[model samples]
Each structure stands twice: as structure tokens, then as C-alpha cells.
Target: MLKGLGESLQVTLRKLRGLPVVDREALEEVLKELERALLSADVKVELVQQMLENVRQRAFKEDIPPGVSRRDYVIKIIYDELTNLLGRRYHPLTLVKRQLTKIMLVGIQGSGKTTTLAKLARYYQKRGYKVAAIAGDTFRPGAYDQLRQLLEPIGVEVYGDPNEKKSTKVVKKGLKYFEKKKIDLLLIDTAGRHKEEKGLLKEMQQIAKIAQPDEIILVIDGTIGQQAYAQADAFNRTTPVGSIIVTKLDGSSKGGGAVSAVAATGAKIRFYGDGETIEDLEEFDPVRFVANLLGLGDLQGILQRIAEATSTEQQEELMEAFKRGRITLQHFKMQLESVAEAGTLRRILSKLPGVGKGGPFSGLPVDEMDDESVKVFLAILRAMTREELENPKIIKGTRIHRIARGSGTHPDLVRALLKQFNQTQAMLKRMRKMRKQRGVPGMGGIPGMQGPPF
Candidate 1:
């Protein structure tokens, strides 16, 4: 994750978080912080100034939505602006049926092109694409061996010529070799070259002519600070780059140098390699990226994750409980555990409409149930019998004592948990009535419990 920029944005958001009306002066203060954050992230000064001016103009021109507060609206504006700043969206690589797509990887020296090639290979390979890789980086000593080691174990066909010095000739031979097979995607990894390295740059250009790739992917090294922009520009100038991949982003918090780089290359960033592992590559989705960057926890992403991770039968059971307007100790525990499962509870709550600071559930005691406390509550839940869990009314006096003993906790602790559950149930009933007043649809499922730790 882009931690540095994320923290800066979050700090800016927090400054306006509870403010019902964000006046001109307050917004200016926040914008200054935002400008600093983006600039620090290696975003170009011109882009940063333009974004701030746009944000300022929009704040004055735009009206807050009917339900959303001014603060939330401002946050939305920032999110939209950030999304716009980051290429808007990545160009999704869609493999055509019964068609062989060729992709050429080119980048400056030590930009992690070879590893990215393997990651892309695995990414396509897992999706049932007949993927193959070509070791066109003949200048590198262990380029062929490295490509082979990465792809061979994964059952991806890797072609290379150790004897060949010319990258263009190697790529030509590789294309001829893979043409006989039913390969879907042929990835050609060209040797690393600098903007100053005319010979290597020429070799890359020559290879592009020889291979006539469907897409020329320019890989930018994320850790190179602001030099990423120059790197992308040089390659694109020599041979037009179709799409870009940013590598070595893991633990990178200082800046997103790719911002200026994308502007220079005029290419949509397709993928980002976040870690050393092949599985760490992800689509550079601006929406989710900005949403997560500001710690808003990507609401749609949360919904998608819940759909993927939870079963329909389980959802139905939870939905039934919500419909009855009575959740058992089990349902309560599920709500608590679900928050623990999805990152920090604060983030999940931030996405909810009027919940955390200036919302309806502002003082809902979220601090009481942290991760450790959730674990204890879950343990207490586990100690209860099926009937007691389903109908917590039975767990009084001796039953509470028994549960406490069984769960290795004090009897008062069990009582405290029971009391909190009662309080939460009452609050949820009030919320349901409010939802009805607001004409919101019946909310259910494990995802319905996607906010505020306990």
C-alpha cells in the first residue's frame, strides 16, 4: 500500500472529518496539506498545483448531496480528483479467444522487468491462458536462467537463446519457435536500458520492429523517486509504449513517482508489482487505490470481497435474523468477528453513511471492542452451547458462570459482554427504524456488520 501518501491524505481528511460546514479557510488549510502529500509522493509540482486549484474551484461550485454532509462531499471531491490524477484507470489486458497476443516488456536497467514478466505470465496462466515467455534480454548474464526458473515450475513455456547476443534476433527466433505451439500470450522481456544508453535503447527499438508486439509494456521502477517520469518518457520517445507496469512498490510510502511517469508516457498503467512474489502483481485500479489510500476502505470492494468470501446459505441465515429484527448472541458475534476480519474497524465505518464522527452512530462505543477484545468475545461465544448461543436470554446467573468458566474468563466479564450485546441489539433496533424512516432497503448478510469493531 502507498502508506506515506495514505497517511497524508488521511490526516487531511481528519482535519475536516467532523466539521459540518467546511468554510473557505478550513479547506485552504487542508488543501495545503494535500498539496504537500502529493508533491512529496513525487507527483509533479504543476500537477499538484492544478489539482489544488481544481479542488478549490469545485468546492465553491458544487453543492453537497441531499444526504451527505459537507465534509463527506469534500472527501468525495478529493477522491475523485486523486482518481483523475492517476491515469483515471488501467487498460485491462483482455486476451482474445483463438488469438495469440504478443506483449513486449521494456524498461531502464534494474526496473524489475524480468520479474514482472514472470508475474504477468503467472497472472495470465492461472486464468487458463496458454502463456509463454521469451528471454530477449541477452545482455543480462542470467536472464534466460532467471526466466526459466520462474516459469518452468509453474508449467509456463519459456523460450530463450543463450548464444544469441542481439535481442532483436533472439526475439525473432523466439516468435518463430512459439508460432508452432498454441500459445495465447507471448511475453518478450527486453534488456534493461537507460535513456543515456543509446545502444541498448536502439536494441529495444530494433526488437520492437522485429517482434511487432501487440502491446509494448514500459516497466517503471517505483523506488527511483522522480526519475520514473524521465524513464517512461525516454522509452516512449524511442518506441511508443502502449501500456505501463510499475514495479518494486512494496513498502514504498515516500511517493508515487508513476504519477509523472504516466503523464510523460501517455500510457495507461496496466499492472503494479507490489512485492517480490509473482502473486503480488495487481491491476492499478485508481478508484480502489484512492479509496484505500484515504483509508475509506473501498465500499464496493468490501461488498465484492464479502460476496466472494461468504456463502449464500450463510447470508440467507443472517438476512433472516435481520428481517426478524432480533439477532441472537451468534449473530452479534458474527458482526463483531466480521469487523475483525475486514481491516481496521475505523476504515469500514468511514465508508458507512453518517456512522463514525458526525453520523448517527458517532458515540457507538467502537473503541471498547478492539481486535483483542473481539477475540475474547469470540472465545466467549465458542464456550456457549448451540441453544444458548441461538437464544442468549437463557444465559443468565449459573449459565453465565458456566460459560465464563468454560471460556477461561471471569463471570463478570461474561455479564459485561451480555450487557454490551443487549445495548448493541437495542441500538441496532433503533437503526433499523431509522433505516425504515429513510426508506433504505433491508440491510442484511455478514457485510451488513461491516463497521465499528464491536
Candidate 2:
């Protein structure tokens, strides 16, 4: 989703970095390129122009503090403007413990409100909350059953009177029933409507009055583009939208439109649904999002994942190699050890830059290789000298045989290790190339690395 926008943004930034001096003309060209990328993503023309003008004004006025380069200064200005275009800070859901926190969801019909309600319920459940949901969408034929099937399996009880005609009455009864259940998070799925659908809108207002939810959440479809602003505006006008959730981003080229549109309405985008699965929801963070958008590859997210996946000492060593933008046999061994403990090689491999299933390292066994295979790799790595470990490329056919003899393994196994090492090195080279392609920093997710990252 918005992959083309990212690519175009990267290209613009790359061209900006190539300029020898930061001047008015160069800045103008870069901002124009950025404008095209944003427009292509269906961002509203007025918003894009406003944001670019902000970037231009800030980039020229701010003084380069101390050691910062002029190029970096301008880049930082652009990055900040883009981040502010979404939202300056992360707005998390207000979840209270040992009590019922009622959250009512609202959106236009066919905007994924019900599906997002189910996913939100699942998200809270996974985080140790005692969640329950009320199917207040009585107008929909199977709304009650849908909520039952989606939430019941996860141990979240669904409260809905399918035969009830009035949504407000159903919500009132469901709230009273769940009051005895000690539900921590009570979700209310309201009826979807058009801004002009007075009947449904009245019902939604009635549900809100009866439920009196702590928060009113608006779920927007990512494919709706700039029209999302009108929907958000209408809902906010009715009940004052507290937050937003964007769905269908996995299939929407106009995701930027929905995001920016909601942002324009001054509603904090709390979460986004990237895929259809219940677990596809993610908390929205503007900095991480903008980083990924500009092809910086979610460096902060990658860092947190790596820190959780690897041991502290191994994490230090691995991150050191990341800073250097190289992976030796020693680093590879650490990765295998971590994989053995975590048993999540696929999880790690999938997030790595340019090294997923069909990536440069695709030929290396990802899913098929098991614990026993890891042991073999460790034994072979142990047989190598420091020089050989540092520079595995120098180890040819003869060195492979020698290592096999030292480790008491077959030469074929040794060759396999070397092949994987080559693949790993190739993957690192590709990551470094991408990192260097960045017009600003945060590409490889390394904190102290020198040079701008794409």
C-alpha cells in the first residue's frame, strides 16, 4: 500500500541529496517532487501545498545548530513537516483496569466499522483485558451473529439482542448484562450511516445517548480517499469523534488520502488495519509511519523487535555490525543462536530489509532449517579461525574441506554454510545500499551510524 508513493518520495529525496549546495532552486525542486508523490497518493491538494509551504518556510529560517550540516538541517525540516502532517504525537487508547471502559465505534456504512470492532476486541483480549462487545448495529441483518463468531472464539462474550429493533434498547440491555460480567473493555458497535441518512444517524445518536461511552471511535476505510474527511467531519459533528481507526490499508493505494483526511479533521488516528486478520491491527505512530513512507524502513520498530528477539550481549554485537553495515560469520552465529532460543526465524527474516521470502537471501533455507540444522551451523562456525570467521569469502573449496574435517562434518555441509554466509553478506550489502539511498537518517535503524539514510 502506497509503495509507489514511498518509491517516488525516496527518489525525490535522493535527488535533493545529490545537489552540492542547498539553495532556493534545489529546495523548490525537491518540494515539487514531494508534492507530486503526495498528490499521487490521493492526499488533498490544499493539505499537500500547505505542508510543503511549511517545510519550505521552516527549512530556510532555522539556523544550522553546531555540527549539523545544511543538507541535514533541510532534511530534518521536511521530515518534521511530514510527521506533523499525520500527527505530532502518538495517541493511545484509554484503557482502564478493573473497570468497564465503554468505547462506541461509529462510521459510514461499508467503512469496516464492524470488522474493526471485532479486531479491537481481539487486540484488547491479547493484552490481558477482559473484553466484551455489544452488537448495537441492529439494522444489519447478521450483525449479532458476526460479533458472536468473531469474539466468542477469543473468550470475549458478545451481548446483542438480534430480534431487538431499536439499537439503543439493545445497547442498554447489553450494558446492564455486562455490568455483572466485570468486563474491562466493553465495545459498542454502532450502526453505520451516510452523513445524510437521517434515520440511521438518529439511531446512532440514540445509541450514543444510552451507552454514554467513554470514547467514540470512528473507523474509516483506507480506500475512501479524501471523502473520509466528510465522513469524519459528520461523525465528529454528531458525537465528537474521540479517535479514528483506518482499515483496508493492505489493499488501498489511497491510504494516504484517508490518513491525511482524518488528520485534517483534527482526529487522532489511533490505529490502522493493514490486513483482514484480527491481528492485523497496529497502533499508529507518526514518526515510525513517516519513516516507513519515505523508505527509511521503520528503523525504530526494527530496533525494538531486535532488542526483544536477541540477547543483550548478542544484540549489542549485532547492532554494532548493523552500524558498520556488514555481517561476518560471527554475527551470523549470533543470529542462529537467537533464532534457536526465539524459534522465530521467519519472524525475524520477514522484517529484515531486503531479505524476506523472495529476497536476496531467499535461496537460504528459512522455514525448512530447524534446530538440528542450527547445531550443525554452530559446529562448523566453531571450527573456523578468527580470520576465516571475519572474512568467510576467502574460504574457497579447499577451506570448506578443511573446516569440514575440523568439525567432523561433511564437506557438503561446509559448502552449505559458506553459501548461506554469501547470501547473508549479499543481503547486508543490499541493506547498506538502501541505507545510503536515504536523503536523511534512520534507514538501517542504527542510532549512531554516519551518513544520511534513504
By TM-score, the best candidate is 1
The C-alpha stretches of model 2 lying farther than 4 A from their native spots are 195-200, 297-454
Model 1, runs deviating above 4 Å? 195-200, 237-241, 298-454
After superposing all C-alphas onto the true structure, candidate 1 shows an RMSD in angstroms of 18.3
TM-score of each: 0.64, 0.63
Q: How does candidate 1 fare on TM-score?
A: 0.64
Write one digit per residue (lDDT tens) for candidate 2, span 143-239.
8998888877888888889789888889999999988888899999987755453554565667788999888887888897888887666666666
lDDT of 2 at 175: 90
- Each prediction's total of clashing residue pairs, residues at least 3 apart in sequence or on different chains, is 1, 2
